[model samples]
Target: MKGLLVFFFIFILIGPIVADVPVREEQFIYSIMAFNGRDYSRTFCGENSDTIYLIADQDNFITTSKTLVYYWPITGDWKTDTRSLNYSFEGTLELTEKRRESRIIYPERYTFYNVKGEYEQNWKVAMGDEADKAWQHYQGLIDEYWQATYQYEQAKMAFDLMVDELAMKITEMRNDGIDVTGLVEKLKRLGPPESPKPPDDYIVPPMPVQSAFILNLPRGEYNICFINEDSAVMESSEKRVVVFEKRRADGIGFEVIPGDKWTRPVESKRSSSVLYVNGTTDLYLRPFFQDEYNDLYYQRMIRNDAKGNPSLMNWVYIQQVPGGRIEVTKNNHTSAILVEEPFYVEQTKGSALGYKIVPFDPEGAHKDRDPSLIAFKIPITRETSLIKFELLDNSGLNMAGSSRQVRVIIKSRWQPILLVLCLLPLLVMTVVRMIRSRKYSL
Candidate 1:
């Protein structure tokens, strides 16, 4: 009886572990490019799942593909091996929503791209021949960019050599006691070769595909299944769809951009959180308009099996607030009014590790390079302390709850305190041990 109980307990433990090693099996998967109120994200529904969540009143895309599907036990989500064997199905998707009869939708070419606007994105989608034209135009632009890049590379190489030659000539003239200031002026006139500018293709156009069934529906429960060309519903294709709505619109947040690393930023959704800065680099804080939604619904909409709190809320960044000023106050005194400006971060030369953030002007030195980012530059000094930031609308009205505290930290100044704190623990231990020894002896 003891041996049998041990066997049962071991089986119970290892049964889950064995089951979690999911084998890749052939199945039909609904590959999707779902819009989550803010942006379009790529996710999928497979044989292992029966539901997909999406936001309403927007166009969401779906297409069927026969591929090797498997459960990713770690993430508790289904994944597909599309590269191995991905086969498309020729069928129509039948959607049955509440109070509506089942309607069939056909797949067509579709594409989307964000055109221009330094602070915000203008994401636009096109379908049918328009999508085809957009895709072709984008591809043509990409090809032209590559060709221009090759030419620019050659030009840059020549420019660098010319600069080097000029430097050598200046050295030679100086050694020979000849004035070379004119040559220096000529070198200055010969600016850097303009870099090849890529197209304004902030594009997330469909890849490995150019067609899908576009589903733009209102908020309600939906039933979706693939129907074959012969008007027969495919097996394992039926799934439930939960179309949810955003809870709160007009939420406020800041897209916190740091000085040194602009590409990689730490985003804080909490409006009450303090913005900490170091003395060395300035920060570019971009205030954004966002919407609030239930965390559970939002995450599940993005990923099939994502977990979140129903009570907690999430912020969906909708757009960058156009034309605003950030008021910087120190000790309750208005210090400066920061206006929106473009800035460029130039990386230091070879073998050195640092960056310099400077005001970006398209017609200036960075004319050859694109503006890294645009925001209100928060210039910090050594004496900066407890600074308050207030966001104002274009009409000069102060946005409520948008106020935040900025604290400048000098990490080096804490060294002495940290050293003393570290030694205090050892000091206490030594004194206690000595006192105990003396007491025991007495």
Candidate 2:
């Protein structure tokens, strides 16, 4: 009876606490995403007056739509915009001045290519401004293929029926004790019709037309407003536009890939930044051409945020480049021009399994596989602590943008001994206590 009363009291006290949790409500907002050559880049709008930046001489698409947004407390990030409610707001994007208009390219046939040494896709536009004609031509080809397929199917059905009928007649004649040896020989020679091959290199036509706006303007401020059907400017549809140029275009940057952690690559943007590493380690370096721009203007251009620091500058990676050799100088004297080499990671055998990295040999072990990276192996010795790197072009000229330093910190060999010494006092105290307790009990 007492246990029951306590259980009822506990349940009554906890019920209201669980029921008071609040549920998130769905809210609608505008969404804008643009395709920047490779993939779609989303521009999140935090407020109505945020500015949106876009690169000049590129393709950009803009659409205004309503979407559901909810805050998830677990992740602390906004949930994906679901249920696209495209509210019809008939308007025209009005710019202050006439920007460079994009050329309407009607690619009849296009081929995709991987950009050399860069993470971008290059599309080769072929036969421009005849999209309708190309669509009609491809439609005609599809119809012809369909007709051929249909005719082949009908002919195959008819052949199968005739073969079945002949076999039935032969069976009937055989039951009647009539000679059908010559007919059987002819039937053996007549096999089923072969399937027709599809048309060679048939490529489906792409989009009928592609339109883009080229934003090639000088460094200045601009405004873009949407004029509604009533010819009135939409208050929330107005967005600020800033056109800025790169500060410097001839800077070289590096994507530093550590041997221990390759996925978490660090960028060496400026020439004076020092890369610190502990003990002997292998480093894979990928050089890139970078440009500097204002942080506020650049960030606002990429995302629609009301708060941005206009005073700071940031480096933007343009593309990766080759034909450069890296020179590693240790302690300002011992230096070596490091060339690109292949490496292989071999897994260890037995109970204590591990991985061992060695110089890759294409003709021997790694014949079937390609080298993971074209890297320079730097063995950090204990005596040589400070190291600096200089990038040189193929003609043996120093690359001003690729100069950086590496500082090595020697690992302490007495760390294990120190840890043991610290734990010895505790172990001795524990043993003494045990000994004292035994002596007292006795």
Candidate 3:
């Protein structure tokens, strides 16, 4: 009976694995071009979601797309197949607040590109005519690049033929015992044709059909739905819109990546966090200013669902500090100023997970090695007890609200256990002496 029960359990577990199952389902999803407190990004709401969230007082974008939606059981998340099966809906969006206020919105054109100076803080968004112009400019750059590439290819072929002919002549001169020093020098001076360069990938291509309804509303709850040509409201396209704002704004935070554990970087959401480590550590600190928001509301704004605690506050990173150095104060007096520089993380053996973080020197053999991180390096030692770090501008003034302290608690390994074991004989002797005294007195 026990054997039969075990067999039944095995059969039940393998039944799904042995059978063919369709994990994907067709559904109309509301794709969004959302403003995530800093910049506009793409996110979606599938059949599993009934509400759409956004940061209040910002231009949020949304559109309707019919695509194949699937449940990814591994991550327990819903994914969409938009490339092969995306069918865009043609309709205007209607937003009604409290059933008293109503607004109809048409699709708007928008594009974004990373600007050169102050990159983190300057992701410029072009809208309408500006969007069209920027896209056309990018297209023109593409055409010019192709033309240049073709010309270079033709010139390179001729250059290669000339190089080969010159090589043959030089060989003949050498064989005939003639002085070919000048000819060799001339050949050495000849170089290959320069390759044509492509445009920056950060200038996003514009999509006309991917039009979205931009909503820039103050804090409130609103009901939004798609309006078709037949003057009918799309029930499947309906969603509850929640426009929220940040609680605490512009607080500096750091993503502390330790040398030993590269993958498991510790996030100091606030500038200050206690670091409990062993002996010594080197940290790669990427600092940014951010705002605190409701955990649930912020997640709901960026993704399909609010997957965190509603009561807790979540820090949303906005941008890196402009022209600042990291001042690390050891024991609150002795200090070291760490400037932001490129550093490379060199991996030793394959799968051994050994990494050495070194300063990037472009002139030496390390020139070919691309930098893995651009951050302020903070070195901690056993002698240093407390650490306080703050951001400072070029004028040597402290950035307000950018100060934080880290209390380092070094951990000892097996010391307490060894001490107890060493004192066992002393404890035994004390007990024996007490027993002997009591026996003699009795």
- Give the runs in model 2 whose Cα sits over 4 Å from its true position: 1-40, 46-49, 56-59, 71-84, 87-90, 97-216, 305-308, 345-357, 410-442
Candidates in order, TM-scores: namely 0.65, 0.60, 0.84
lDDT of 3 by residue, 293-388 (tens): 889988877777549788899888887776689888988798889899888777776877577888888888487668788888888777877888
Q: Tens digits of per-residue lDDT for model 2 on 131-150?
A: 44545655676688888888
- Candidate 1's TM-score reads 0.65
Best-matching candidate per lDDT: 1
Q: Candidates sorted by lDDT, descending order?
A: 1, 3, 2
lDDT of 1 by residue, 1-442 (tens): 9999999999999887875457889998888788876678888888777887888888888989889988788876778899988999898999998788988899988887766656455677878888877778878888899999999999999999999999999999989999999999998899888997877656454342277899887878899999987889888899998887887786678887777777777665666888777756677788888888878878877887677888988888888788889888885766788899888888887988988778897897888778888888877676877678888888888887678887887667668898899899899999999999999995
Error of 2 at 377 (Å): 2.7
How close to the true structure is residue 344 of candidate 1, measured as C-alpha lDDT?
A: 81
- Comparing 1 with 3 on TM-score, the higher-scoring candidate is 3
lDDT of 3: 0.80
Report residue 8 deviation for candidate 1 (angstroms): 27
What's the true lDDT of residue 294 in model 3? 88
Instruction: State each model's CA lDDT, in order.
Output: 0.82, 0.64, 0.80
Candidate 1 regions off by >4 Å? 1-22, 71-78, 117-119, 129-209, 258-264, 274-282, 344-367, 371-373, 379-385, 407-442
Q: How accurate is candidate 2 locally (lDDT)?
A: 0.64
